[model samples]
Target chain A: MTGHPHDHGHAHAPAAAEDGPPSEYARLGRAVREILVEKGILSAADVRRAIEAMDARGPHLGARMVARAWHDLAYKARLLADGTAAAAELGIEMGPTILKVVENTAAVHNLIVCTLCSCYPRMVLGIPPDWYKSRPYRSRAVHEPRSVLAEFGTVIPDDVEVRVHDSTADLRYLVLPRRPAGTEGWSEAALASLVTRDSMIGVSLARSAHEPVETA
Target chain B: MSDTPLRRHHDMGGLPAGRVERADHVLAAWEKEVDALLVLLSRQGIIRVDELRRGIEALPPDAYDRLGYYERWIHSITAALVEKGVLTQAEVADRVATIAAREEAER
Candidate 1:
């Protein structure tokens, strides 16, 4: 599913030396990784497998969870109660981190951020978008969530109370967006088609029934 | 930005910044490699996420500001490995130089 189109550019391109060599940091990282592999701390094949594992997961798993919650009240209650276990129910490996699902009701909206570091629920969302780690998003998400959301084309009404969750600690949050109107009697899979990564991050809402689902 | 009493380098919630830009989700080849290395290191119990976070936080403010996301990860991962005595700075430097020379020879 498509995420909110927040245009925070990559702040730093991979650094290059004056003579067009790789940046010190990049070279150092490669050197250390190679040394570790040689020392038998890790193997090249292990690195390859890890990359494959991470690449296998994406927002589709989260969409499935949200879709199930939309159709099943019992599942919704469980998801809100224990997001990690709920995600595990669908065979989503959350690793060692905890997943906390926050609900957006008509009266209150929730936004997620990690002021200290980008502590995201990567198991479901995969790697955080570059913008999510940008300085603007990290600072503004908690202070001016409304404006930030507005920048994403998600304008929350003035009457609604905005509750910003700063993920400073272990508990990572996923926003369970309020299911859109006109989605009644739809199958879970069909409803899941409306969920987007941005919506789960609480930066934007799910696509309305009228919007076409954009496949990644 | 300098670290303020209200906001540290890591404390970014509610600070005034700029607009979020839209970009492609493409990862550079080196980035993918580093990403894999990070997961592999963590999975092998060589470093914990908390330890990695601490390493990132320990970076100089200017470096933290200047580095990209995966750059920070690479920096922290390297630091963690060194701090844990898994790899020494001298060895890493030597290896980096060797790799650079090898690449130059190839070119």
Candidate 2:
């Protein structure tokens, strides 16, 4: 079950990034990159800087935003109203991407997927997980969402309707998981620790008050 | 990639597929380079993200399956540059051969 069992039937890991050699396409990438630098189309330093900047981002940024929303209702209203502007308030660059934050309520559980390539909230969550770009997730998430959630060990009760958001290149979606119970009066940093990347993706819920928060 | 009324292959929403393999992996070095290249390209207005997706979707079904996420991306990036007349096909081909030979000699 590692791969999609669709028109193509095989079981492969989503991304064993370093398992193989530098493929022909890999060499092509290097060649293209070198060519670009040689012609001054883009400098090598620019590429390095871009990578560093992209890698510097992660779910922690999204966690901070979510934690703030939980602590302040006004921020929550702002986040839902214009995500790009709200993110700017915290200095998270949305650039040209229009951000949409969906909240999970008692009656509804939201899941986000990019059926087209792997369009994700990279500004907030960094790079998406490899499986998020895999065929299975792109294919099944919009249809059998409940089953997909179940596979991720997230079970939404039948009473709670599952809403699957199909993201596009113009807009990206992030799920603000419901604040877990027993977290009353928690500090913002402590509350942020409970927001995992998967919870933001809506594959699972935020860590509960009793769940061990990773201090690292 | 187009404003086509028809559905594109990448548009796989609601389709039947296998179970999701809920896992994550650190990106490979080359993948990061590819990612950076695309980002710079977009920032430089050389290629838009939508154009990249179009190039990716235009890939033959076999190559689509054979390559990983960034693998497909490199091809698209290369194609976009060539399309923009920024780089020629022969130059890229020759450069790839040279790089491959150098790597082989180093090994």
Candidate 3:
């Protein structure tokens, strides 16, 4: 599956810089907009409205999928077996343009990285977070997933295993980490509480009621 | 130009950012890609070199550090363009409408 080929090239460097207190990118964008108007490529009103829309969409439906699976065993099983279908079952539809989701399980601890560029499953997981598309995470994750995980403060047991899923083509992955112990009667919402974005990407495990960790 | 996107061919390692060594490797690659883009866009007249240079200079010392990754750049650009009217609201609405239509049609 492919995503909307939004500009993923070098043409965006100056504008792609990080936002500070005042957000320099915003200022640069204004400059770029002025140039575009002078060149007759776009109108000011049009650009302002479009940015508003992008923000409204927020993260993709995949975050909900992860939350659901954390609470239900059968759904988690189905998600693991057929991610695209399972997601639809929850009203999360995938388009021809949308990338398919792959669930990484315990036998194979699935990790996601976009090595070449940031091709991701945005429809489900929202936008691929910044770190997922970086060159370092992509390059080293494939070469040394364990070492990479350790950097994130995630230490996989020797027996748990690791499997890195490159986010390319139509196949983007979400890790269905093994549910932690000590929360037998936890509600789905409660379980969802433990499913951090990092764990969903498979670098860490979902927190159990007993061993809670910081999730941002 | 008309091939499977090159991003699919390269291998991405892990998530939540990797170790400094891995992080450095990835950031360097993205920075290189960004530089290449600056040059190419300038050649295409999509951007001016002086303007780009000024913009680059104006960047916060921790601009990249605050965001700390390349994909953030991609996200912000996409967001900023959409905001600045470089991308059209109607275009996004129409694409979304088209996707919704196709789904209804499929069912």
Candidate 4:
């Protein structure tokens, strides 16, 4: 009681209710769900299944797709034109999503985001991780990709160009990062070890197992 | 004869943004839910198997066919419903209207 102010000496009572009730995002999601059910576009069971599939096979499928694109050139071209067919080539079945792959080359660095909403390539790339849906990343990634990539520890040189793709159409995107050096004779599986999820999203470059993943 | 003063460029009215993030969020949630409902109803023997199959068949092939596993099956039902007239365009429009109206009322 002498020097500093006595702040919350009662061991800090439990926090009060949230400032404003449900967030806008939650409200919107609820309203949309109601509309979909009423319109016969969606059902409760469908949501459950989607959540399940997202947990089970989404990431593995994305990893496999990235691996395949790394090893094959002709297949990569095919993927660019038609992602669904390309995915099928690798025997990764497509349910109903028509995915599109966008390759990132020496000159162009491709980034993907759904400006309208989170229209990720779930069929191929899998359900986007939570970070992709965050407001700051979602809003800024498209507009300032290089800066974002830098934050992720993959800095593109001044000469390199950056192109951000907004996944609004039925098509989705996956970045085919340029092949890394010193791994000339490596097998496809070995090459695949380097294709991190962040790399596939064009936010960072792929790194070998030897190169430690930089903490965010 | 007097002439009317020219309208100020800054005074012109503006339309709202074409795309609404909140609306998209809701619609996406709805689409997923709708697709799942059809699948569940079909599995539960509530909706005819053939009818569900028909609905799935009605989805846009380019988009739906590329969907993975369950989603493919789900969208198929959406197509079938559209074809069977179980889910009509007018019905969808009406539902959207209702949601919009409710939102306006809340505001």
What are the per-residue Cα lDDT tens digits for candidate 4 across A1-216? 111101222122222232123233323333434555555655544656654554455555666677666677777778788888888887876664577777777788888876544557666666566556544466667666666677777788888888898776566777777777776776777777777777777877877647753442
Q: Model 2, B3: alpha-carbon shift in Å?
A: 21
Specify the CAPRI tier of model 1: medium
TM-score of every candidate's chain A: 0.87, 0.89, 0.69, 0.71
For model 1, how does the per-residue alpha-carbon lDDT over A1-216 read when each residue is reduced to its tens digit?
111111112122333232145667667666776788778887667766676677778888899999999999999999999999999999997887899999999998899888778888889988889888888888888778888898999999999999999888778899999999999999988999999999999999999988987644
lDDT tens string, model 2, B1-107? 88868766777888778888877777766677799889988988999988899999999888887888888999998898899999999999998898677667655
Name the regions of candidate 3 deviating beyond 4 angstroms.
Answer: A1-18, A21-28, A31-61, A89-100, A211-216, B1-18, B21-107
What DockQ do the predictions score, one after another? 0.49, 0.49, 0.12, 0.07
Docking class of 2: medium
lDDT comparing candidate 1 with the true structure: 0.81
The TM-scores that each candidate's chain B achieves against the reference are 0.87, 0.89, 0.34, 0.37
Best by lDDT: 2
The C-alpha RMSD of each candidate to the native structure, in angstroms, is 6.7, 7.7, 14.3, 14.5
Docking quality category of candidate 3 according to DockQ thresholds: incorrect
Cα displacement (angstroms), candidate 2, residue A89, comes to 1.1
TM-score of chain A of 3: 0.69
For residues A124-190, could you state the per-residue lDDT of candidate 3 as single tens digits?
6554555665556767877788887888888877886677766656576666656677767767666
Poorest 10 consecutive residues by lDDT, candidate 3 chain A? A1-10
In order, candidate lDDTs are 0.81, 0.85, 0.53, 0.57
Q: In angstroms, give how far residue B4 of model 2 lies from its true place.
A: 16
